[model samples]
Target: MNNIENIRPLISVIMPAYNAENYIEDAINSVLSQSYEEWELIIIDDCSSDKTLKIAEKLSNNDSRLKLIKNSKNIGVSETRNKAINLALGEWIAFLDSDDLWENAKLEKQIAHANKVGASFVFTGSSYINKEGKPFKGVFEVPESVDFNKLKRQNVIPCSSVLVRKECFETIRMERDNMHEDYAAWLRILKSGILAFGVNEPLLVYRLSVSSKSGNKFKTIGMNYRVFRSIEMNPVSSVYFAGVNLVNSLKKYNKILFKNKKIKRLRLTNPL
Candidate 1:
């Protein structure tokens, strides 16, 4: 027989939230529904003006595993996440945006994979969900493994789907104030000679809100370029990598659009 109390938590989830009242509850519920029970969720409210903090507080009261941390002022997402990471107690740290969700088996499967291969960092595939919580067309499929060179061209790792060993951050932490800071952090990890593995299953449902920074495609492009140049410190390398990122991004969305069109055409022709 297995002893529940004897087993220490393997993962600590970090969620940095600001003005997430509309969908934050759903995100919390997703964690509550996880099949893996030995984990902790630390939700930091970044001085949200809305009911985001209140909701998180209410949920935390019901479960000891769920913790709520409120910021004194509106620190950005990067700082909020870093604070939570610094306080994390589990051997592994996982990220989940306040508005995104995970399938019940996500932690269970990812932890097994990590133990099997001894990977320091791992991410899974993710699909988009619209404001209405309906499945969208864009689905990100990542390669099996990524190194510094492969990641430089295109950052296919989704922050929300990642599970990283706690010690990996000993040398590098998330850049507190930068566009695409998560991308910069991942690049730093890979550059340090750590191999990141990707599980090909879509274990995350990333919410696409129009008001979000990443929802603005043009702004994201500029941010990607800035991240490469400013952090990577090579204008020529930045341009080459930025170009590859742009082209790959276009192909990803175009493929989604094409699939939607083909489905619509089939529906019209078959009257189904």
Candidate 2:
């Protein structure tokens, strides 16, 4: 055993898995490969009928640090993640989706940055990886430090790339019906006067699959409308956010249509 291992602070990684057999291993491996060695992987299986639960159980059995929790009934991602967070024993909490992955030095780098900057919460840039496992070149850029004013304009933080102090959960509660739970939680935290800092490094790979919940435009638009309405504000700001959300939804629809056309052309040529 190494001497440094004994002094390392415990980092609890909360992962909510649901029918993610194909990508779960990669997700687990990403955490296992982290340069920061003292961490626990808390995987909550949301009653997946697929091999996801079995695989998670196997991994937990192999590693003492990997803790597996099974839900008796199928709950949504928000509930599953909240349960995992409640069960975590670490001083710091990090979220990783079963279909996404982190770079090897992600935890170490982020922890160092947080400690140096004295930030309670930290998020990093991430590259988008398509279903075929090809990573896109562009990275999502967010403000280095967020305030309520900045967050109201846009939600640039990605949940899978976030690392926050465990105490943050005491103030921000996850909404079960909110499709973008991270954004909602961040807004709540910001409203409470806590500023979240961002790391510019692309330390995570956010997987984008055709079947992803966010891929549904109509559902996302509906959810955004709900989010705008949920915020405690005057009628004027509410209308402003609603209009901003509508334009954002239309932009996404246009991008999706263009991508679909390109995909159709490729299919015609390759016949795959």
Best by TM-score: 1
* lDDT (C-alpha) at residue 254 in model 2: 47
**Pairs that collide, model 2:** none
Top candidate on lDDT is 1
TM-score of each: 0.88, 0.84
Stretches off by above 4 angstroms in model 2 are 1-7, 211-218, 234-236, 245-272
TM-score of 2: 0.84
Task: Tell me the deviation in Å of residue 36 in model 2.
Answer: 0.7
Query: Model 1 over residues 1-272: C-alpha lDDT tens digits?
Result: 33532344568999999899999999999999999888999999998999999999999999999989999988798888889999999999999988889999998888777766778899999877767787767577888999988887777888889999999887777764547788888888888889999999989888754342344455556677777875656877776777788777666656655755633211100000
Model 2 gets an lDDT of 0.76
lDDT of 2 by residue, 1-272 (tens): 54543446789999999899988988999999999988999999999989998988888898899999999998888888889889999989999989889999998988887877878889997766766677644565556888877776666677888899899898566775555666778788888888889888879888764443444545555565556566666666766765565565355334434645534211100000
Q: Which 10 residues in a row give candidate 1 its minimum summed lDDT?
A: 263-272
Query: All candidates' lDDT scores?
Result: 0.80, 0.76
Q: Which regions of candidate 1 fall more than 4 Å away from where they truly are? A: 1-9, 210-218, 261-272
